[model samples]
Target chain A: MRISELSERSGLPVQTIKFYIREGLLPKGVNSAATRAEYDETHLERLRLIRALREAGDLPVAAIRRVITALEDPGIGLHDLFGTAAYAIGPRVEEPGDDPAWRAARREVDALLEELGWRVTEEAPARTVLAQAFVALRRLGFTPSPAALRPYAQAAAALAEHETGQLREDTTRAQALRMLAATVVYDQVLVALHRLAQEDASARRFGAS
Target chain B: MRISELSERSGLPVQTIKFYIREGLLPKGVNSAATRAEYDETHLERLRLIRALREAGDLPVAAIRRVITALEDPGIGLHDLFGTAAYAIGPRVEEPGDDPAWRAARREVDALLEELGWRVTEEAPARTVLAQAFVALRRLGFTPSPAALRPYAQAAAALAEHETGQLREDTTRAQALRMLAATVVYDQVLVALHRLAQEDASARRFGAS
Candidate 1:
């Protein structure tokens, strides 16, 4: 197939495909003449894999080259290739269903934020955080079954949304938001603050002892 | 305060604090004498900020230095500082509370898997898919409240947990785990895959119908 056909089949652009070839991520085709050349199934498969690596994995082109090269090595096993591919995908989890229990938890969290006088971002969700954590967890050897972590996911989402809303406060909008808030790195500041509050508050009301 | 006091208060070891100073992430203290230096609240505040940038924001020392320098410029506005800090942390929002949602999502996802008669993962959470998504979302933006994301988190966790368990079936345990499951760079792959899926899936499920 021509470069356009390859792009259509692989869902990549001809320019990108050409760039990949120029960047050595893709090997040049066998010399048919000075300007034109022929490609084979190997090229198509390689192109698809490259698209997979680039689009889904967000890998740098250099890394993609190394991945494809490694996969092409006949000495490697199929398991290794797929596993690498999976790793390359990084995190592969998603929400399994739309359930009421999940919604109830969100409602409870929303209410807590309201009671605490916080701005609630209704559309905020925690799936994104799970994605980053998934990459770390996958690295840690726990594939994590959904049954084990659903509660955490839901709770986490609410927590993150509520917390960020704090950053966006407009009470002192005339002054830059940075001045009203501590100039400390936002994540650590809130995480440490929340944790300290959680520990002290929980102990005060429902002492572990 | 002495370095020891600073370390204790900030929960950072003295050596790391010293490293931060050496790396220019922290401002130098005024000299108390020819050989010693005196530190104070300004130093403490800076150290806390440093910790936040490194851990939550994952800013490299060089990048953190750049952010600080940018913010120090009197001509620069608060909005620019915020954007600079965000870039330093990596091109993503550092929203908190994402983990719990993922954990919750992982839980419910498993129950659904059992209902479907899918071989559930012992190590992976059904929310594995969501877990991956969380990482992605964080990379994209880190603001979802943990509680709000519960359902999405749990469901994705369940799905991923189920998908991940299948890896073992394809190859030797050691090989699969090492090549695909263990490599840190697998994130490189998973990130790409998730993105590809997102583009296609969103088009299929949410595009104009």
Candidate 2:
């Protein structure tokens, strides 16, 4: 197919498609003739993935490139690939200078991880992410009790079991990539759902109207 | 106390405190004399809450103002105050036209809400948020089964019950405002924890090393 056809099929502008090719986000098509290259099914699929990551997942171009690179690397396992994508797009937590509040929060996070017996790396960005939240909570004078966070951990474990279960049965790399993308992006959805559920529960118990 | 004292206590720059006062996010201190104003403990508390909402919750100034206004309203109940904050910070899901994928996704969201017997309003931003995730999933060619979403809903409900339970025992309007701020900001924490837990579970099940 021609660039125009690829653009029509992918619902992207032809100029934007060319830009992606220039940025190495999409591959250049074969030069069948002068000034004209023919694309294939792979181009269409890649374009769709790129669009989903950019628009739906809100990933920056560099992060999307890292994800794509991981997907292309046969040496990377499924778990590592997922981790790569998550690390590339996850929130960044600035180092909290040596404040007592931050120190206490870090201790609490360490305790929670030990109690859960989970195997996340010490260097995982998520450790910092959780620690930052704790610091913020303490600064606001509201520390979450261990009992309160336990249900969230249990829920996360249950969801992770389900997610990993689905990944184990994958048939092709393309399918695996799709599943990984959905998994990472869906976290945002999960948070929204939780907030909505809170509203519903609040309405049931204390809504004025 | 004066503006400098309020600034020191709140850990905010005097200029930033003045900016918040100017923006109506914080109330102005009393005019003590020329080139000076008197700030009380209430000013310090409000400043802290404003900073928490801005930095931890990532709420816009306008949204924070709305939350503050709700908190100040004598007629507003605890539930309504929470609703105001949640509605203010929830993700906005723009209509995705009439694509079959989107229509199907919207129906799925509607059905899921019904099955859960949740009482979310029709205009709740979360409904659109869930629908958008479903649409993105289908576009990526991976439709999540109801079984997969059930655990998430159950977890959300459990967390919400815990959150609302705490508010029930709150003593004063000031305390309630602080609780609402914590609840809203902690959602970010919950998400980070969930991601960290998923990584742990993944490492246990499929770690390369």
TM-scores, all candidates, are 0.30, 0.77
Q: Which candidate is the best by DockQ?
A: 2
Q: Which candidate comes out best when scored by TM-score?
A: 2
* TM per candidate, chain B: 0.43, 0.83
lDDT string, candidate 2, A44-108, tens digits: 98888787677645788888888888888899986787688667656658766887877787788
Report the number of clashing residue pairs per model.
Answer: 106, 0
Q: Taking the tens digit of each residue's C-alpha lDDT, what string does model 1 give over B20-114?
A: 88887787777888877778876775665555555545657787787668756767543344335533443233324557765653454455444
Which CAPRI category fits model 2? Answer: medium
Off by over 4 Å in 1: A1-88, A92-209, B11-16, B19-24, B30-36, B55-62, B73-75, B92-209
Q: Considering only N, C-alpha and C atoms within 3 Å, which residue pairs clash in candidate 2?
A: none
Considering summed lDDT, which 10 consecutive residues are worst modelled in model 1 chain A? A174-183
